[model samples]
Structure formats: structure tokens, C-alpha cells
Target: MGRYILKRVGYMFLTLLIITTITFFLMHSIPGDPLAHMAKNLPEQVKQNYYKKYGLDEPVFVQYGKFLKNIVTEGNLGESLRYPGRSVTDTVLENSKVSGRIGFQAVSIGIVIGITLGVIAALFRNKWPDYLVMFIAILGITVPTFIIAALFQYLLTVKFEILPTTGWGSFKHTILPTIALAFTPIATYARYMRSNVLEVSNQDYILTAQAKGVSQFNIVIKHILRNAILPAITILGPQIAGIFTGSFVIEKIFGIPGLGSYYITSINDRDYTMIIGTTIFYAAIFVVAQLLTDILYGIVDPRIRVSNKDQ
Candidate 1:
């Protein structure tokens, strides 16, 4: 298990390195100055100084080397081009708190509610409850997150005035955005859980338990959900990215100050450091999430560990 975990961690770092290299080169290939927004007004010497100061005048490989060095030795992500004097790490850490809070709520809501709905749907298969859950899952999967965010803003904030229209401060500010971000995952997990539950229900052990006079509740609690939930855990790895990406527009729509908002703005303004830093940050998140999911997968199913060792 320790060897497997160390291997996964090593792979995670390798993945981050590849993502960073790709993002850096891609940003450079875009054929525009990172300081273009301010270049028009600055004197030629000042513009040149800006370029040299940012190591932009150097070769790409030189810049990449320095960037990697700083990250390894100093844990620095460089300074933001858009926000002068502010480090990219600081910006990311600061705004991530907001995004983190909303993301935590979103994932929690999705897991609990999605699992419950899946169980209910599985229990009531071929009934109206199952149909309704399937309909909701279809709606969530088919509709884009931005549309859901927009409609939520309109109906909940504009039409009914049930929640704040926009801004970030209190718990009320988080509700709409959290739910909007959660919708897709809720749908995804519901389908995954329901399918797993149905499959687990048919297993020989389930029938054996039933024949042994085990109560329905114990059979489900001990056998059905336990096994069914293992598959659902794997979905969390990819869904973390989905929730964060979905939060980009949702944060913008709701006027929340989160990392996603800064990431989008950095792209538009061609802030290379901010863009690269945030991209790396998000990629790290995805890699770490997948690592955790893999660990959890092994813990839940000992066969996975044995298989991994055999590999």
C-alpha cells in the first residue's frame, strides 16, 4: 500500500510537470505580449524594461528553467502581470478559499443528495420516483452549467428574490452557486450509484443474505450500498474538475471572488504568469483528487491492492 501510494504521488508530480510544460509553451505560442494591455501607453524603453524585467526577452527555455527553479526552491509561482506587486501564489491562495468553500458545499450536496436519490430510485425502480430521478439526471447532464446558473440567478434571485442576486460574503451568497455547480455531479453520481446499486443487488451474496433471513435494511446497508458506493468514489476524481470549471461562470454570474474568476480574467488579459500559475494550481487539484480517489478505491476493495501489486 505504501509503495502504491508513493508511486501514485510520483506520477502526480510527473503529470503536473507535463501540464506545466505544455501550458507554458502554449502561452508563449499565442503570438501576443503578456504586457500588451499596458504596452501601448508605455515608452519604448519602459516597455523594453518591462519585457526584460519579466524575463520575456530571454529564450523560452531559459524562462522555463527559472520558473521551475523558483517553484522548486522557493515555492514561488512568480508575480501576476495583471496585478502588479502581487504574487500568483498569493492570489491563488486567497481566492481559492472562496472557491474551496463553495466547492466543498457543492460536492457534499451532490454526494449526499445524489446517493439518496439514487438509492430511492433503485428501490422504486419502474415507479414514478425512479422516472423523476432519471428525468432530473438527464436534464442535468444535457443542459450546460452556465444555462443552469443563469436560470437559477433569474428564478431565485430576480424573479422570487429568495436569495441575493450576486456577491460573496455570507452563507446565503453561496447557496445558488453551490447548487448550480453541484447539479452536474449530482446527476452523474446518481446515475453511477443507481447502476451500481442495481448491479450489486443481483450478486450471489445479496441472494444468499436474503435467503438467510437477513432484514432488508441490513442487507442493503451491509451489502448493497457498501459495494455500490465503491464505484461511485471513482467518479469524484473527474467531477472535481467539472465542479471547478463550472464555478468559473457561476462565480462570474454571482460576482464571487474566486480563483476561477481570476483565471478567466488572466486569460483575457494575456497574463502569462497568472494564467500558468492558476492552470498549474487547477491541474494539481485534479491530480491530487485522482490520487485520493485511487487510494480510497484500494482501501474499499482489497482486490485492487492485490491487482496493483501484481501489475
Candidate 2:
């Protein structure tokens, strides 16, 4: 188990390195002068100084080497080209807090809603309750998040005047964006959980549990849900990117101040450091989420053996 964990950690570092390298080269490869997008025009000499200051004047490989070294040693992501004085790390930190909060709420709502609906659908398969759950899940999956966000803003804020249309503050402000951000995942997980639950229902152990006169509630919660939800972890490993993408769209629609909003602006402005920084940040998140999910598999299922011997 320790060796497997160590190996996963090593792979995480390698993945981040590749992501940083690809993002840095890709940013530099774009055909445009970074100085051209600056807030104000500068003299030729001043532009050259800006290029040199950012080490853009150096060979790409040299700059890449320095970039890795600085991040490893000093945790410096360099100053943001757009923000001028703020470091990339600071900018990401400030904005990530907002994104993280939204992502957390969105996922929490999604998991609860999806799992509950899925369980009901599975238990009453072929009945009206099952059809109702499937119908809602289908709508969630097929409808685009942007459309949902727009409709939510118009109906909830403009029509009903119950929720705010823009800005981030207070619980009321989060209601619409959170719903918009959660729809896709709720659909995806509902399908996944329902399918897994049906499959688990057919296993011999379930029959044995039933034969033993186990209460239906205990069987569903203690046995069915615990086992059925295990497969959902597989989905979560890749869902981090989905959550970020949803947050991006939802944030833009509602004017929330998250890293996703800033990350998009950084791309439009061609802020190389900010682009690379956010890309690396996302890569790190993907790697860590997958690792944690792997660890959780063992805890959730005793059948998942983790021997010390290397695979």
C-alpha cells in the first residue's frame, strides 16, 4: 500500500511537470507580442526590457528550466502580466477560494440529489417514480449549462425576483449558479448510481440478506447504498475537470469572482504566467483528486486488496 501510494505521488509530480511544460510552450508559441496587449503602449527599448525582464528573450528551453526551478525552490509563479504587481500564486489563491467554494457546494448538492433520485428510481424500477427520476435526469443531461444558467437568472431574478441575477455574496446569491453548476453532475451521477444499484441488487448476497429477514431500510442503506456508491468514485476522478468547466460557465453567467473567470480573462489577454499557473493548478487538482479516490477505494471495499508487494 505504501509503495502504491508513493508511486502515485511520483506520477502526480511527473504529470504536473508535463502540464507546466506544455502550457508554457503553448503560451509562448502563440503568434503575438505580449507587450502589445499591455495596458499602455511603450517605446521599443522599454518593450525589449519587458521581454527581457520576463525572460521571454531567452531560448524557450532556458526559460522552461528556470520556470521549473523557481516554482520548486521559491514557489514563485512570477508576476501576472495583466495585474502587473500581483504574483501568479497570489492571484490564483485569491480567486481559487471563490471557485473552490462554489465547486464544493455544487458537488455537494449534486451528490445528494443524484444519489437520492437514483436510489428511488432503482427501488421502484418500472414504476412512475423511476420514470420521473429518469425524466429529470435526461433533462439535466441534455440541457446545456449556459442555457440553464440564463433561464435561471431570468426566471428566478427577473421574473420572480427571489434570487439575485449577478454578483457573489450571501446564500441567496449562490442559489442560481449553484443549481446551474450542479445540473450536469446530478444527471451523470444519477445514471451511474441507478445502474450500479440495479446491478448490485441482482447479486446473491442481496438475496441472502433478504432471506435473513433484514429490514428493507437497513438493507438499502447499509448494504445497497454502501456498495452501489463505490463505482461512483470512478466517475469522480474525471469529474474534477467537469466541475471546473461548469464553474467557469456558471461564474461567467453570474459574474462570480472565481479562478475560472480570471483564467478566461488571462487567456484573452495572453497572460503567459497566469495561463501556465492556472493550468498547473488544475493539473495538480486532477492528480490529487484521483489519488484520494484511489485511497478511498480500499477503505470503502474490503475486497480491494492492497498488498505491499509492488504490482
Q: Using TM-score as the measure, which candidate wins? A: 1
Question: Which residue runs does candidate 1 get wrong by more than 4 Å?
Answer: 308-311
Per-residue C-alpha lDDT of model 1 across residues 12-59, encoded as one tens digit per residue: 999999999999999999987778778879899999998888899999
TM-score of each: 0.96, 0.95
Clashing pairs in 1: none
lDDT of 2 by residue, 10-89 (tens): 99999888888888888888887776768257788898888888888889899999998999999999988877788999
The root-mean-square deviation over C-alpha atoms between each candidate and the true structure, in angstroms, is: 1.4, 1.6
Clash pairs, candidate 2, are none
Please report the TM-score between candidate 1 and the true structure.
0.96
Which ranges of candidate 2 are over 4 A from the true structure? 307-311
Best by lDDT: 1
